[model samples]
Target: MRRLRRLLLLLTCLAIAVPPVAVYSDAVAQERVQRRTVLDLLFGGFGFGRRAQQQPNYQQRQQQHRPQTRSEKPKTKKKVPPAIAVPEPVVVAKLPDARKVLVVGDFIASGIGDGLTEAFTEMPGVAIEARTNGSSGLVRQDYYNWQTELPALIDEIKPAVVVLSLGANDRQMMTIGGSKEKFRSEAWSKEYEQRVAALSSFVLEKKVPLMWVGMPAFQTTSMTADMSAFNTIYRGTVEKTGGTFVDIWDGFVDESGKFVVTGSDINGQQVRLRGSDGVSMTKAGKRKMAFYVEKEIRRILGDAMTIGQPQGGEAVSNLVVTTPTDAADIVRTQPISLTDPALDGGTVLLGGSALDKGSGRSPRDKMIQKGEFAAAPEGRVDDFRLDKRPQPIDPQKATN
Candidate 1:
C-alpha cells in the first residue's frame, strides 16, 4: 500500500512537472499549448508528456478557420470604337436676284421645306422660303386663313414658284355661310374644292407657277384612305386651276400598296422613312418627299436652277443681243425640209435609180413596193423549201 501511494505521488509530481515544462516550451516557441489534467496524465491520455502538439501555425489556423469564398476572374473593360464623322452639305451663297421658292402649309409642308432646303442647298441661283403654320388647314379659317395670308406672302416674297402642301389637318368640321358642315359631306366637299381653287387661283393671278404636292399615305388605314381622297380632290381642283399636282403615293407604300414605315430612299437604299407616331416624317422621309417636288420645280424653273456661276462676273439674263456691223455682212442659210435627200448626203431616194430589164430587182424591193414577203433565210424555221439536205460543215469554220 505504501508503494502504491508513492507511485501515485510520483505520477502527480510528474504531471505537475510536465505542465510547467510544456508552458516553458510553449513560451520559448511562442505557440499556444493545451493544459493537461492530473487524471489524464495518470491514465496516459494522448499527448500527456510530449510537448502539447505544437498548436498549428497562427496563419495556417486562421486560413483553415476562415470562411470559403467563390473564386472570381478579374473583370476586364471592353474597347469601344470611335464614331465616324459625317460631312455636312456645303451651301453656296445665293445671288441678290436668286429666284425664291415659297413653301406654305402645315407640319408636312414644313418637312418639305426642310427637304427642299437640303435639295437646293448647293444651288446658288435658287432659294427656298418656307412660311408654314403647323396646325393650320383650309377648314380652320378662324384659326388661320390661308386665303387672307397667301396674297400678302405672294406680294412679299415674289416667289418664282409657289409650293403648297396642306390638308393634313383639314379632316375636321368646316363652317360655310355661318353653318358648320361635317367633313367630307357634299357641302363640305364643295366648300373645300372652292377653297382649293381660290387659293390656287390667287397664286395663279400673281403669275407664280403653283405646285400642289399631294398628300402621301399615312400609317393609319383611315388616315391613308382620307389622304387618298384628299389627293383626288387636290388633283382635280389643282388641275382645273392650271396648277401642277405632284403625286407621291408610290414612294411611301410597299409593293402591295400598303403603307410602309421603311421604304426606298432618294438613293434607292432601304431606310426608315416615317416616324413612330405615323403622322410625322423622319429625315429620310422628308428628303424622299421632297424628291417629287424637286422634279417639278426643276422642270418649271429650267435654266434658272443652274448650280454654280462664274465667280467674279455680273449676273446676266439668258437672252443675248448682238449688233451686226452691216446687214449685207450677215450670212444666212435657207431652211431645208427634214425629208430632203440631201440630209442623208444622197441626191436620190432609196430605189430611185432605174433598173435595166436584164437586171431584175431584189426580193426586198418587190416586198416593199407590192407588199410581198421576202424569202426566209435558209436553215431558218420559216424556210419551207422542199430540199432538206444537210450541208457539210467547213473544217476551217468549225475549227474557228
Candidate 2:
C-alpha cells in the first residue's frame, strides 16, 4: 500500500511539470508571429521612400511636357495728338461783275437782310435785296421748293452773291418719289443731303459765290441737338461744294454750350440777343448774326475798300434818265459792265456817261423831290408773321 502511494504522488508531480512546459511553448510561438509582422512593416516603408525619391516634382514634369515660348517685352501705349480744325478756303464768283447781293432763306434770313440794310446804309453803293419767306424750307416742296425756286430766283435777281439760311424748318419729313420719310432717318438724311448738294451745286454752276449760314441752338434740348447735327452736315456739304459755311452757333451759346437769350451787342452794350421763344433772335441778335457774315463779305469784297468802287475799272456815275428806256438802252447805260447801282436809287447812273458834277440833282435827290422814295418803312413789330394767317401744315410732313 506504501509503494502504491509513492507512485501516485510521482505521477501527480509529472502532470504539473508537463502542463508548464506546454504553456511556455505557446508563448514563444506568439512572440515569433509579432516579430515577423514588424519586419514586413519596416520593409514596406523603405520601398515607399525609394519610390518617392525617384519620382520627378510636378513643376519638373510640366517643364518636360510643355513647349516653351520665346520671351517678349511688354507692349507700351503710344501717345496720340489731338486734331485741329482748319478753315476751308472761300470760292468767289468769276462771271457777273454785279455787286448786288441776294439773300434767301427762312425768317432768319430776313433778319440778316435787315441787319445788312442797316450796316450798308452808310455805303449807298452796295445793294442788298432779300427774298426771304418765313414759312419756307427744303422739306416742303408743295409750299415753296427752294431747290426749284432758287434757280429761277437767281435768274431774276442776277445777284453777284447769294446767302442761304434755311434748315430751321427742315427738321421735318421729306417726300421722296411719293414715299414719305421721317426726318433724320437714313432715307430722309440721304435725300436731304442730296437736295442740299443740289442747291449748292446750282449756286456754284451759276458761278455765284454762296454763303450758307448754320442754324442756331434752340431752348429745346432736342432741337439744339438736331441743329448741331444739321450744322455738321451743312459744314461738310458747303465746304465740299466750295461754299462758305458761316457758324453762328458759338455766338448764341454760352461758354458751356447752353443757349443764351441775352449777350453783349456789337456796340459793347448788354442787350437781348434772342427772342422770348429762344428759337428766334432779337433785333440785336440779328445784327450779331450779320456781324459774322459781314466779316466774310468784307474779305470777299477786297477788305471793304472796293465795296463802293465799281469793278472792271468802270467809272462811278450818278446819272439818271427822266424817261423810261428800252432794255437795250438800259443795258447800254451801264457802261461799267458791272452792276446797275441805280437799282437802289442811291447811285443811279445818269445819261450813260461818266460821273459828272452837273446832273439835275442826283437820282437820290430827284426821288426825294418827287416823294417817290423814302426811308425804309419802319419794320413791322410782328416780324415773325404772327399776324399773318397760319398756313395748314400736313401732319405727315412733320418731323423732328
Candidate 3:
C-alpha cells in the first residue's frame, strides 16, 4: 500500500511538470511569431525601415491631384481692361547685335516665354526680347488700348525681326463706337479692315522685318475659324509690308484645321506640341517653337557669319547631398534630362541597361523610361513626365 501511494504521488508530479513545459513552449512560439511579423513590416517593401511608411500617403496624394483636370478656379472678375493692344516684345536692354531678336504676341506667345528666352542660349551671340501682355492684338478686340502700348514696344525694342504673334483673343464681341453695336455687321468688318491696314502701315514704318505667326487651331472649331479670319488680316498685312509671314498655324494645326499635337519635328523625331492645359505649349511645343525661331535666326545669320563647322555640346550640373543623421544613409540618386522624357506609367528604366519592353533607358540618371505601360510595349509613350517637376516623372536620365 505504501509503494502504491508513492508511485501515485510521483505520477501526479510528472503530469504537473509536463503541463508547465507545454505552456512555456507555447509562449515561446507566440513570441517568435510576433517578432517575425514586426521584422517583416520593418524590412519588407510593404512597410519597412524609414520612408516606407509614408509611401502610401504620398501615393494617395498623387492619385488625388493627378491630371484629372479638376476645375478649381479661383474667383475672378470679368471686367476687361482698356489698355489692351499688341505691345512690342521686351528685350534684355543690351545684348549684342547678333543676339538682338524680337518675340511678339499675346498670352500664347508668353507661355513658357521665360523658357523660350532661355532657349536663345543655344545661339552664341543671340538674345531674345518680347513685349506681349494680356489681351493684346493687331486688330479686332472685345475692347483694349493698343494706342498706348504698341508704339512704346516698337520704339524701345527696335528689333531686327519683329515676331508678331497675336489674334487668339481678338475673336470676341464688344462695343463698336462708330457703329454703336458689336463688330459683326459690314460696317464693323470695314472698320476692322481699316484698323488692320493702319497696324500694317505702322509696322512697315518701323522698318523691322516682321514674322507674322498665325494662330494654332483651338479645340473649338468656331475659335479656329475666328483665328483664320484674324490670320487673314495678318497675312495681308505681312504681304503688303514686305515682311515674312510664317504660317505656324499649320505647324500646330491639323489637316482638319484642328489643333494638332503630333508630328515628326524638324529634328526627325515624332513629337506632340500642346500642353494638357488645353491652350498651352508642352515642352515639345516650346522646343518646336524655338526651332522655328532658330530656323529664322539661322537664315538671318547666314547673311552675316561664315559657317566653319557644326558643333554639339551638352551642359551638366551635379548635386552632392549629405545629412547629419542616420548611420548608413541610403543614397538613391535619379538623373534628369532637360530635353528628354521618362516614365510610361508605373514601370521604370534608369539606364539603357534597365529598359524592358515598355521603357527606354536614359543616360541622365533620370528615368528615361519607367511606369505602367498597357498601350505601347515599344511604341511612342504618353505618360512620361518629370520625376519632381510635375509628373512624378522619371526624366530622361540615368538611374544608377
Query: TM-score for all predictions?
Result: 0.61, 0.52, 0.48
Tens digits of lDDT, candidate 3, 47-66: 34324445686688899888
Winner on lDDT between 1 and 3 is 1
Candidate 2 error regions (>4 Å) = 1-98, 303-400
* Minimal lDDT window, size 10, model 3: 313-322
Each model's C-alpha lDDT?
Answer: 0.85, 0.76, 0.60
Q: How many clashes show up per model?
A: 0, 3, 28
lDDT of 2 by residue, 1-400 (tens): 9999999999999898885444457546533322234555677664455445545554577878887665544557787787787866433332334367799999988888888766655443456789999999889989998888899989998886898998889878889999999889999998888888889989999999999999988899999999999998899998999999999899888899998889888887889998888878888989998887876665555433244444665332321113345655654433332466555544445454456667567658969788665333235553554346556888888853
Task: Say which candidate scores most in lDDT.
Answer: 1
Residue 81 Cα positional deviation in candidate 2, in Å, after optimal superposition: 67
Candidate 1 regions exceeding 4 Å error are 1-83, 307-377, 380-400
**TM-score ranking from best candidate downward:** 1, 2, 3
Sequence-dependent TM-score of model 3 = 0.48
Give the C-alpha lDDT of model 2: 0.76
